[model samples]
Target: MTSISASEGCEKGLAPGHFAPETAYLDTASAGLPPAEAVTAITSALTAASRGTATVGGYFEAAADARARFARLVGVAPGRVAISASAAVHTGLIAQSLPAGSEVLVADGDFASLVNPFHVRPDLRVRTVPLERLADGVRPGTALVAVSAVQSADGRLADLDRIAAAARAHGARTLVDASQSAGWLPLDAGAYDFTLVVGYKWLLAPKGTSFLVVPEDLGGLTPVFAGWVAGEDPWGSCYGQVTRLADCARRFDETPAFFSYVGARHSLALVEELGVERIGRHDVALADRFRAGLADLGRTPVPAPGSAIVAVPGLGTAAGRLAAAGVRVSSRAGGLRAAFHLYNTAADVDRLLEVIAGT
Candidate 1:
């Protein structure tokens, strides 16, 4: 079996000491372990807050800094990114913007946060297609095509390039949920009309931080949830109706989560320093190692080439046993879901394999 050495697994800025020594954590698909820098930043923020030294201005600044860093990571202008508390909130904004009776195309079994808003609208026509046929399912009447860049249930990769092209041909807008792909996958937020990402899963930020990217024209989305923070000058516009909304995507912003952003700034900085391309290579290598071990044990995971997530059918019940044995993973869609990231190594994969073998 191929092995990735400790030196190869541990990037310069990301050390093994960043995580707990006893846990073989392969659950990055659920939530990432924040690096030491992020932990320190959050702790310092909390300390200041306790002493009443934490300023709202400082919090906003940290959020802005994190926003800029995220924009750079996803290859979009900062002006196009809107900060929100969750992907579902941003997805609702898009769903609200669509005209009643407009058709929305989505992949079958896509994350509920991405598909639920449209389904609940009642006035919209929501169509589900197999992920492999998502692009071909587009038609002239389709108002939007929404999908995840990587499937959360089975780690299947969506064909973004094809979907984007098809959407353009049909004059339909595109919304991509990159919550599962952002940290380890190289992405261009500019490729779609709308892109949504929740930071906790892969970007390593706290739960309340999320981002939405919209076209320069705001992609005709109405800022239904706009509040004081969405005003041209938030502090100045707090009392009355927002006399003027921000000219850019900030008009879609929710009030920033101060503490979350404090940690997010540092976490995103670490991601930038390590670089996405390098992280992608490292993550996939470990995932492939896991896949090889699974094959040796006569288990075949859902086919996801070049992906860092592996989901094995009929092994969902093993999750509890694996976790008790100190190997952390998730059970999703009646399968065992193991996600590898920058911090995972060959030893972690082997540890999971050993646990699975015993089970």
Candidate 2:
């Protein structure tokens, strides 16, 4: 392990420079380091819970606040924000909103959690569109095309604009699993040609936490209807009084993981303070530096030059040996493997390159 760090400066407060193992952290494309603030948020919530202050009342209020933070980050309305325990849960709600016979399309090899729901549902038909064959065909009955913005395996950035426009032309709804691209990309829901996309990964937010942004004027998609507090109508009514689901993205059921919400909110707050585009700019610059450093090895970049993830191909048999050393990069289906996120530094990249070169 080696010592190195990065930091952000904000008004009214100045965060100290971070220090973590440079040799150890390139693997964070696997799981990132939790922010100091997020850790504090969780501790504070647990403290409140221990003190009998984790009330149902406070939970809803915090949920609404979380909704606003997340909505602003993703460029959507608080009402459009549906607090889902997982991106798949958000997709399940979208599935229910559309017709039963809907056909959906997506990358064949995405993180499994995103694909399992459609496969399990008998009424819905799902198709795997290999990156090469993405333009193949969409039948008339195709209702939704579920895709990951940046596929987990090779880290290819999905062309959201193209896919969104295609779905619009075909009259099919688009469900982009923005899981891995959230913290890495500049995703404005308002700017999104695609109406619905949920952020999960790369955001450094907790697992099982995601935000879904649906279009503004679609007439009553479907009611997610899974929140107990939501049933009570957060505006001021009791549960039974409000039988209707939320009109915006909140239509999906959301469990009040107040602690996780606080953690995520803190992360978003940091992202906002530091600036999303700024964070992304830094990430891309780091990746380009890493890629350039690999020139001696005749390596090539991944399919798309995405921010959160980057690859150095041509490792061949050397790749397996590198993993045994506890370097922590998992393989994608294709020959390419990748590294990601802000926890990484130039030193980490050099070490990975050193491993490959030494091999």
Candidate 3:
């Protein structure tokens, strides 16, 4: 359980000046504050659009840059990554690819976007198991084992290596929703058959930007949602039927949200510059500091060792008070959930503890 001191984290690129001076934001799991660079990029894009100087090619290039950065972050080739609007969009595509009556194993109480898509398809058999038991739930009949790498309600991390191995042993594919883990956790997206990440949260990008990584063979998923962006020559295929789709995972691409991608490109650059391992150590240090403070206050948080999210039971009711005190956090599953990122500090952890102690 190594950690980076707040000062060390700042040196590594946690620019506190980019955030509001008065607020202690501990809710990255909900949405991250975009860095100054990302904000500038977004504003520039908007200005260019308003001036009628924005080109479609520029937007496409921005998206391509973002896609490659994300692939690098997750240890995959850019050709294996598909630009997406949301994790649900990719989840639905995976669901559509499943044969009728295929068994889909999912973690109970996982994020709705990851679980609902499978449930919506009545033809599929969806089974729910506890996150801890998800690996054991994989069976001979399981077509896919879908779970979040990090639980949103609580900070429970799935045993991804074990689950992936079990799925492989059972002849099933694995789909991992990394929305909660990507920026602050080191993830090898290539280990799973499908890995989906939404950039608005930990990646510190704008909404409407996400990424999906699939196996080299495309993991048997059909590009049912593909539009002009999925074409081998996107501009050329804009009007009529696509004469040829992309040979790689780009064939599954959703039309890029230009403004979001424009911002995402710069945001992901910051992440790469700082490195995920450094961010994770900084984040976990802050979370551990908070956990220790809560223990001294006679409050117990859900046990999550080495995690960047701390969920304290019975403190959900204190969220409004904390928010009023300028400490931003989230209330979920009847608890107060505070997520730490590279930007968080020891002072932020102390402020949260002081408010909770008062409440």
lDDT of 2 at 334: 46
lDDT of 1 by residue, 1-359 (tens): 24344347643324466655458888989998888888898999999999989889999999999999999999999999999989999999999999999999999999999999999999999999999999999998999999999999999999999999999999999999999999999999998999999999788888889999999999899999989999989999889799999999999999988889998998898888778877887888788888999999999999999898999999999999998998999999999999998778788888899999988
| Candidate 2 lDDT by residue in tens digits, 249-292 | 55564665667676776666666666666666556666666677
C-alpha lDDT (0 to 100) for residue 286 of candidate 2: 62
Per-residue lDDT tens digits of candidate 3, residues 298-341?
99999888889999987898899999999999999999999998
Model 3 TM-score?
A: 0.97
Q: Rate the local accuracy (lDDT) of all candidates.
A: 0.91, 0.62, 0.90
Position 22, candidate 3: lDDT: 55
After TM-score superposition, the amount by which residue 282's alpha carbon in candidate 1 deviates from its true location, in angstroms, is: 0.4
- Winner on lDDT between 1 and 2 is 1
